[model samples]
Target: MNKTVSLDEIPYSPDSCERFEALRELPGAAFLDSSYPHSSSGRYDIMCAQPVACPEQPALAATETAWQQYFDELRRFHKDYYGTVQPASQDIPFCGGLLGALGYDGGNSLNQVSGAPPATRNSGGHLAAYNWAVVQDHLLQRAVMVAQPSMREADRNDVLSRLRSQRRVKHTEFQLGGKFESNFTESEYRSAFESVQSYIHAGDCYQVNLAQRFNAPFTGDPWTAYRQLRRTASAPFSAYLSFENNDVMMSLSPERFLSLHGNHVQTVPIKGTRPRYRDSGADRLAVEELKRSSKDRAENLMIVDLLRNDLGRSCIPGSIHVDALFEVQSFPTVHHLVSTISGELSPDRSAYELLRDSFPGGSITGAPKRRAMEIIAELEPDSREIYCGSVMYISADGRMDSNIAIRSLLCTDNDIRCWGGGGIVADSQWRQEYQETFDKVGKFLSVLEEMS
Candidate 1:
């Protein structure tokens, strides 16, 4: 059954920006901040939960009909004010409120992707939380959401140390979280190269994203940990995903999958990558390498084409264009060559239509999306619940924004798992591609090890 509790019942001042942080400190309430500044509605949102019996996917899916019904009601309410408020169901993979209803117990769910238990629990990391069902109250008028606080405390250092120990035991561990080439194995690295070559030979797809997993435990205040990561990595658009039994956190990101500002919609796609260096000279060299690498360029351009096509579906005719291409943006651990694809959205299109057109991002899926998805499904045994999905915030005024789900963490009752990877094309060298994944995860793993 669905329940609703006003922000007033919590300790925080609902009107304050810090309401999210205050609510996060509340008892049995896990907070998810969409930070929907692009919308005309309210700013911060929340997702709260009280103890409830666990329900698996089948039982959980049964709520889909009701969820759609509730969403339709919301749409009707906003139709007069705004052309259409993006439905809650329209929020992609990491939709905040929907993730809460999906539950926070993360034990078996962790193994579902990693094939091994995670070091921590809470796996609803990147969600497409859609709607809120208020049993007794009128629907919320803004982009606000409600989630209860977590039942457990997540300590950073403890979690970090636990991950380090696990890595050692698994023999898959790399020192420095394998940020540089010095830490990873040649065999593992070569495997990625071989896969790229095989894919190329078979003509299955132009590029494919390959990733690996890392685990850790926790010992510090999780909210503090999130703030620290944000300071260190500081993504342009960021999100904090946490649940009662699990937490998924991220800090470094350079892509915007989609956004709805008033009636306008947009998406930014990133397609190339290079590791960052401490020395300015080294950094320049890495960016230079990324720019000059034909393989990377080809891979990036292919995705650009894919993104353009994806946006074209819901976008106004002749409005689609590559705003920026092959622009390198530097992060703490890596340098990435990204592209911006923009379009004037078709007035009749819905958020779900936009997502369906661009479900798995081009960077992750390759040139031809459906074919690449098929290959990915075959190569990977695990189901990508929310990794490639987008995390979005939709206002009551029909405005929204979302980020590509990458460099993210997932947690459940028993484990914590984070995934990172890069796109591989025909000329791709497997070793380099594999190492890139490690580099992407470096800082995250470092923090996790510190806690462990």
Candidate 2:
């Protein structure tokens, strides 16, 4: 059963960002913000909290069996409660189901094909069973609180009452204690770039993405910082997730890893990039430059080909193709060359199966995904953790959506961390490639640093 409570009944303004205020302190909270400007259609913001159950995390999955078993449980749990339930409407992306970030390392544990370094942490990955979510539809200029049949009447009413109140609670102000320190200096990054080039020249992989981590001490809740970043650089696939163990993630990702609506699936991989400029002419030039760069096009094609192969595992034969290529999209901080590839999901396959077959998106890994993984593991010093992973959701009606965890930040143990990197190809210069990493995340770091 699906219960839809209109935004009017919540007593807050139709466009108030505080509509979901009740979920602020709730455990297992997750917000998928579409931030679709101009009040347009084609996107919806979904948020939920207080998961009924979640897998053991930070050490839960030690092997492939453990990984499959947990997901299997989620399938059964959702099926039992939401099998007959559906999204309130076609545009709603989620309607009470599994919602959480699938840390990048989650795939490292589940993937038997990666001959590269095995999952180093031995403890990562989590998915939560959510019974309710507030869906904000910008197109309709309306919102709905959809609750699952599995939830008790008392619980649902309690949630409704809280929403109607629209009570505001004071939160600790978030501040960076100091400037973020990088794990790699210029010389260190150059060394990694050279190694990746050697791998490309040796035919180990076509291109490998290497990254550097930056961290600084911080105090207060990450929610404040997330809001600040969103105000400046909010993306179509942005998300904020707060979990136990002081684990919090704020992702302002512009890359769509995968999305499924019934049998149709699509992926938009971002490849080339150039920073935005304040001058109108300079900005236009940057976009034009990204559009015509041959080296960037070549790099983009390698990942496109890699992803087409990945989708082949579960997509119907003869149904996969590149719908669009070399399209340039301008964001607040940069212009990116993105390409769309889509396929029809095989009738025999489910959404999670498709996800399993194509985890750790190929765009992040290089061509010949296995060898690229090994190269990446050998080059980057620390584990990627959630970066390059995904913020994903599987709905009761089988709708699915996820984002590549680039331009992401994490708060754990008073340490605030974020990563920046890009695909490195044979012709890529070490200096430009190194700077690209910062260009990807530099603005985000500035937002946090300003809070100090």
Candidate 3:
């Protein structure tokens, strides 16, 4: 059953980084900060820590049916609170959503995308798990501690007191090892780019997002690294998730895969990118260039069309439509052409059903999504566990929100793995596409070097 305990609002400064550090003492924490707070309804910044309940190490299912069953059970645990409270007439409350990372391999359960299985990877032993915890909403200036109905008042008070008494975090020195290693060499990536082109020419698929992974041995605090990443790339959909076995997922994603408010569902897909120039004049020119680029516009439009169809599977027929199109949004390192699409959920559909129809967001996959995923599985070597998948939350009221896990990192005890790539289209230049990957990951690499 849904249960909320009002707690004393902790003394928090508006500095997101410092606030995050203060809350780091909690185990199995999840922090989400929005870069563009003006775009959201007030509750954009949140920190959920100290899971009241979670799996020890949950394994990812191999099919959608299994995933569906898993989520159903998860939701059933907190159903009373899922969509029980609405802050406003049209707004969904900051109640609850599953907090975890969905790996790229999770796609297998959704559709028949053939590819090599992910390397025998070591990511805290579980692909995905959800948790319920004490959530602090920065915008609301309040903290809501969620617990099982049977939890004792003394135990609840102890959790609240700990959150209220968090100390300032100390800075730690991180050791950076040798140069980062890539799964694919430059020549190999070029060859793959050319191969994708060949497929496009053959009309196999319209577009596909191909990416490469980078890894480096490291010993330090992952939370510090996440703070540095956020400083460098303050994206609207940034998140940090810590698992039970000490594995952490850090994301500074600029794209939203999907969001649900009441019966209204929305998604904003980002398809085009251009590196931001240091000079103000040059930056303006770059933005203008991206705005007028036919290739970039066409690429974005195709994904827009694809997402409309994806939503159609779960939305009322006449309720789906594009809310915005071809709008260029600038970030610290790049400018992106993003489009927003919204629809009314069909009465029979649930959030899990919505995810079933739109897993591994179309923006990351190519047009004719299933076929492009098949090609992606054929070409990419490692399983995209978490990368290009999503960090999501589904509320009992059927409200949900998720981020395309780009500009993300998976941190284990000994090493950090990062991935970067872009869409390959018929007119995509091989050299540009190659550079785009670096442009996307440049901040991540730079922050690691600084911390090292």
Q: For every model shown, what is its TM-score relative to the native structure?
A: 0.66, 0.93, 0.89
Per-model C-alpha lDDT, please? 0.51, 0.80, 0.73
Q: What order do you get sorting by TM-score, best first?
A: 2, 3, 1
Candidate maximizing TM-score: 2
lDDT of 2 at 234: 68
In candidate 3, where is summed lDDT lowest over 10 consecutive residues?
Answer: 123-132
1-452 per-residue lDDT for model 2 (tens digits)? 44442222344234334655577667787888765662222267887888886445434346777776666666666667566664567866787788887777776656643433334331256578888888877766677778776677887777787777746767679988899999899999999899999888997788888889999999998888887887788688888887678688888888999999989999999999999999999999999899889999999999999899989998999999999999998888888999999999999887877887788898887877877877877787777888899998988778999999998988888898899988999899999998899899999988788877
Q: lDDT tens string, model 3, 14-130?
A: 555555665576666677667433324225565655545533323444455666565555545545434353332123244444566677676755666545455334321232322
**Root-mean-square deviation per candidate:** 11.0, 2.7, 3.3
Q: Name the Cα RMSD for model 2.
A: 2.7
- Best-matching candidate per lDDT: 2
User: Which candidate, 2 or 3, would have the higher lDDT against the true structure?
Assistant: 2
Model 2 accuracy (lDDT, Cα): 0.80
- Name the regions of candidate 2 deviating beyond 4 angstroms: 1-16, 36-42, 54-61, 65-70, 113-123
